[model samples]
Target: MKRILFVLFCFAVTSSYSQNKISKNKKAIIASVEKHKQSLIKISDDIWALAETAFEEHQSSKILADYAESQGMTVERGVAGMPTAFVATYGSGKPVISVLGEFDALPGLSQKATPDKNPLKKGAPGHGCGHNMFGAASLGAAIAIKEQIEAGKIKGTVKFFGTPSEEKFFGKIWMVRAGLWDDVDVNISWHPSASIEADVQSSLALIDFKVEFFGQAAHASGDPWNGRSASDALELYTAGVNYYREHVKPTVRMHYHIQDGGQVVNVVPDYSRLWMRVRDTKRSGMLPVYERVMAMAEGAAILANVDYKVSLISGIYEVLPNREGGKIMQSNLELLGPIEYTDEEIAFGKGIQKATGKPEVGMDSKIKPLEPTREHPGGGSTDVGDVSWNVANINLGVTTAPKDTPWHSWAVVSCGGMSIGHKGMIYASKAMSMTMLDLFESPDLVDKVKKEYKERKGDEVYEAMIPDGPPPIDEVGN
Candidate 1:
């Protein structure tokens, strides 16, 4: 009789504890997120004003660090050897949840926030990728979680990673190499897009390199024979790449733009440069083809009689899917509800779409649930791929741009700087905060995710695709 009574008492105590934790979490996070919304807007506006480029986000880093310090978070600056990169942490315990933030802008996308495309400063940089919102939303989630921890409503840790150089440099890859994510249990991130959805598929592995050729210079009209045209070498290299494309795997993608094709036709150009990017579904599959491309560049230099050099800038591995993490994030997304656009916001999106000549309004009226099957691969590249291999990681996208506006465009930048973008930002923050709450409320879910991650990574070691060296922060300004 006494044993039976003790069992009943224990059950009642456990139930009461669970209920109290849930109630406290709900109250704490709701109040925290509400307080965080205004600060998120301010951070977004500040990033938009700075318009910092990849690897060189000095002002953006300062803004994030300042806000994080104000929240009483322990901040680590110049992380992973990148000057603009840092990690801010709060709370003290296991099951660490990380919210990744990017603050990089695209080059030559300068534009005003207007329906008609107008360059704010011709040839200047702009946040066409909506990273302004990206950083702010992630910061908002971190702040909300921090509040929950301070109120003694949660026992786990929350981290905010300020990742730089998403546009050119692979900032997260270096951080991964530096073992910054080793202690993290799971990482979550989101991007500005035309729709809201949790990504369940993988992304391509990518590498960027620069090819330069050196030759003798001479006057075109006076001594053409005395010069070796480096521009000719660049042209030959491009032709070789075009020819090599027909023989490579169908999944391989090679793209290049001439960075320097000589000074003037009047003088036989002495130097030329070409920036190249190579991507494939798998890193191993990409290596052989990348080698072939290098051989082609060498062949071109030999034929053109010009000295050539190839410099690998950065490389990132493909993302590994995390089913358990995806499910948790999807559930929180459902709780947060879909982004409801105001009549004015919808009118603005439509106007931008019309001006851009894209007729589709990709924004749906209802929130879409996570699909059961992974049918398509993520078409873009990210440094997060490197983090996914180390820990269970998943990313989400929220509609902040017009349908079919294409990333890194003036149209996307225009919307990102306006109120329509702020709405998306808030939605993402709420979703992330709720997702973290779910993790805090259900400890078994974290264990399941970690177990799955271990099973998936079985005997597979994460090797940084980038070389072991200093961060390529200098490349940010260029």
Candidate 2:
């Protein structure tokens, strides 16, 4: 009876603390984001114009870091050997809360900000994944936390991790390797998506590697018999992968891009190169599949009388969703209310839906209920998975594009460049900042979040699936 009474007392205190803490500063937190509305949109547009990719996002990275510094946050540039990666910090002491921001464009997706399909630069890079909005929203959240901390209302640390190369090389792996996130108590992250939701889902664990085959070149008509065809090996290896696909599980995905398949068909080609990506719902599920794929490459090389080299480029783990954090974010989402879209916005959404062959249900403004707990990841993979292993993290997706508009496409790029994207960006900023206030006010909540993280993660150690050298800067950038 005494223990039960004490439990009730603790719950009461925690409840009061949570309510009083976030409720008091909620207006100011929102106001901070509202104040930076136009500037944030300009920042997003500048990054979209640059359209840089992966480890080569020098201009975009500098723009984000410069803005963070302008807000009076201490900044560190060129972290983890990637010039575009950085960590901006404010406040001091324990219970370090961090926000993640990514700013990388996809290659070959350039599009003008129009309802119609018009390429801005005809095959140039573009913000197909809406990363332009992702970065600005996170920066807005961190700056709001800085406002509270500076005013002496919050006594914890606020950090913003400027992660680059998310679309290709998985830059956060190096940042995680550098122990940048080791001391963080909790991390907040969000993505621009088709709907607003507290993401309680895991992403796929993936690995990317490149294979190069070498052979002796010879004249096709004269000495063809004396020459080995590297293209033959490449074709054979890909055929084997396709044949083996029938035996693998449905959740596994294997894709490849043939960067080189010989210049001319007249002469026997000497060299060929290709990149491969392997993914699974869980990390363990990927090991055997990768082993079989590699073995097939060896067999192909042997049969084609050529030598092959395999280089592991980059790999990232599936996101481990934190329900505790997800619930907190959901509650905050409810507190903020649904997104209000104007008639013009709805028409704009329909335009994108028409262009993409999707049903014109317009934008998804309603906040979805929290997803049920699951062991396996969803479909896509992200570098934030690595950071989740190191710290307690929650990833939310805000409705930045039209409903049913597929991500990583020109359709998303077009919507993300305009007002629709700005509204979602501001919404995410408020949600993240308000959620951070909950953690700042109540240490009990932080402990609960950590305890849940430890329990879900178990005793498994983290190991990055990359080679023992620097990130593939030149390979990915060039």
Candidate 3:
């Protein structure tokens, strides 16, 4: 009995020591983020003001890459065939940890840092998705981890990925194909959301493509019979898609934008273009719908006597949820407690909620409990989903705007440029940094996270849904 009691006592003492070490390291990491808080906010604000679009974020990317380099990390810019994409690395050895940062803004959402809807520049781009915060906070976390490794408090490597064009082209697809994540043991990622959660939910899988129709132009009234209208084909294709929607599963979502239709009312258009996207809960589920939709374009062309071409833009996989990683992230969130808001911030949040036609409940200050992984999660798509498939990715969502503020809108842009978004960005940096410290300290934790990732991945092989050539850097806008 005494021997057994002694063994248990030793185990307890070792566990206590481990917990103390983790706590101490997390405090240091949090302090590092605090120490560089102003610089981090400046990075976010700079990117926010630049409001550069996908693949065109040259200055935005430079700001982040320069900061990472100044922090003693080696940066390789213009990577994976993208001028805005880059990789920054620090330290050496096993358990390579990677974090993703995106700095692209949505087009035509240009708004100033005011609660009222005021455009900073009419018909310009804005940080509606809060990627300005996403990139900065992620880099801040990576820098914190880099500092720990520099101090000999942790072992292994830390990599920061500057993945651009996520708003349109799914930039990470090309990055993954270039084998950027091949050596990574794990990835830490987060998004600026309206609520805080250790995101265990999977995202929708999506496919983006453009359909162009060609025909012969003629005056509408002068030679009606001689003209075959490409605009007619465009209309029929959209009509066919609408009719097919009722037959699809509840998990399916389809959207299209008519980029070109007709030049004038007096002429039959010879050319028309449409940007189409198809999405489902899983890539496997999305494939058949994408195929059918592509086929519909051919049918439309035949009926309208026009020639149509379908060009692949890009596609992404659903996020592979890592329960092991999520559990660790949840602990860190709980440790940090809910984000407290000052009265001014709360009133600002309420004003946003009111303006956006939602209940004036203000921001969600509570940390949402980790949710069960849904088989058919309902939400938008992301390029991070592709990276998660390649590596064990722990995802997080921190509130950067008020509750129920319509995403990808001026409301989010308003808060993201001000203190509300700044607080959340800092909060995300601390939570992610603390979680990374746990991963760095516990190799067993990394093993468990990878084990879960492999089990979930099973026999399925990852195949990117892009064309044979490089990413469409020349593609116009979001």
Worst 10-residue stretch by lDDT in candidate 2? 14-23
* Model 2 TM-score (2 dp): 0.95
Native-referenced Cα lDDT, model 1: 0.83
lDDT per residue (tens digit) for residues 291-390 in model 3:
9999999999999999999998889999999989999999888777778799999999999888888999988968899888888889899999999989
Model 2, 1-478: lDDT tens per residue? 9999999899677656655655668878988889887888888999989988988788888988999999999999999988889999999998799999999999999999887789999989999999999898999999999999999889989999999999888999999999999889999999999889999899899988998899988998898998899999999999999999999998899999999999987888999998999899888898789888988989999999999998888888888788889988999987776688999999999999998888988989888999897776566889999999889998898999989888899988998898899899999999999999889988998988898889978988999887888877877644
Question: Candidate 1 regions off by >4 Å?
Answer: 1-24, 360-362, 372-378
lDDT for 154 (candidate 1) = 79
Clashes of 3: 0
Off by over 4 Å in 3: 1-22
Model 3's lDDT to the true fold?
Answer: 0.93
TM-score of each: 0.92, 0.95, 0.95
- Please give the clash total of every predicted structure, in order: 0, 0, 0
Indicate the residue-level lDDT of 79 in model 3.
Answer: 89
Backbone clash pairs for candidate 2 read none
lDDT of each: 0.83, 0.90, 0.93
lDDT of 1 by residue, 241-266 (tens): 99888988878899998989998879
How many clashes would you count in candidate 1? 0
